[model samples]
Target: MFAVTVDQVGSRSDDDRVEQAIDVVSTTAAGRLVLPPERTAGDEFQFLLDDAGTLLDVVFALARSDGWSIGIGVGDVEEPVPDSTRAARGDAFVTARAAVDRAKDVPEHLALEVAPGRRLGTADVEPLVTQTVRARQRRSREGWELADLLRAGHSRTEAAELLGVTPQAVAKRWSAADLRSDDAVHAALARLLTEADTPAGADTPA
Candidate 1:
């Protein structure tokens, strides 16, 4: 199981922003949630999941809209897991809180704690985000527009149709945007994490 905690940066300073972030997180996490995300404090939220596979995707999505910190803990949850974050009890929650505290100390916005060796804050998100930033920095205004359309699941042909351009033109912008490489990197990371989460001797997807 994976326990996760998040607190919006300076959310308490602006009550309205906290409310807005809560809505954003809710909307983004709807179908992906295991235990529904819950507000633990006015500015804090918590949830638990049965796997760590999708952690990166969720964190990056939240980071896009606003500033927030996240921590994830991989371990066992006590039997009969409750739907509420407050009602859940286990090493996972304890580790999650610790990781979040560490995240608060550093500039990075995310941390992960793994069990079996007490690997707290083992995953570093900086390199992944750095590559993304580099990719964004290399883009132009037109490139961003084309990239956004592609990111929304539109193919080069579809984006070209929407922009009234040739598919070749859209594909050129897509290459310049480097979103394919970024996505490939993310997909590789997700696979690695899933394999790590799977117990030894248990079969994992190839």
Candidate 2:
């Protein structure tokens, strides 16, 4: 299992933004979530995941908006997570708390902790995912607009029409932003997480 803790960057003056972010995660992340996201305190939210593979999507939700400190922890959780973050007790949650604290000091606005030397997503994959997420966070407005349009299943031509640009220009922006490479990296990372999550004994079914 995995835990994700998120905190809004800076002061509470813009908390409506955090509330909206919470709503987006609540509505869009049901499939990947083992625990529905909850606000634990002012400007902070937390959730649990049944699959580490979905971490990338969750991070995207936090980072694409550019206003969050997102921390992900991969570790054991006490069975039957408590109904609230207050009652939750486990290494995963603790790790998430520490990671979230660290996220406040990082430029990328992301941090992660897993069982030391654990192979789930591996240390290698962690940096790769972080780099990719940072790339997304750094995207220019035009770059991100194209990415959002394409990610929503719109064709390049459609995106062009919507942005009032030529299809070739849209394609150039997409390529220049390295969106295709980022997509490929995300897919590969998801596969790695899936493989890592499978128990070695899984094939020996009872």
lDDT of each: 0.67, 0.75
Q: Write the per-residue lDDT of candidate 1 for residues 1-206, one digit (tens) a residue.
A: 67778887876575545556656655766667667678887678887666443566566656555477777666667888877878998877887888777767655666666555332224543355434534455578778788778778987788899999998888787787776676777777665555545555566545
Error of 1 at 30 (Å): 3.6
The positional error of residue 136 in candidate 1, measured at the CA in angstroms, is 7.1
TM-score of 1: 0.75
lDDT of 2 by residue, 71-180 (tens): 87766688677777556767778878888888889888888876443445446456866787877767888998898898899988999999999989998999878887
C-alpha TM-score for every candidate: 0.75, 0.85
Candidate 1: clashing pairs of residues: none
- Pick by TM-score: which candidate is best? 2
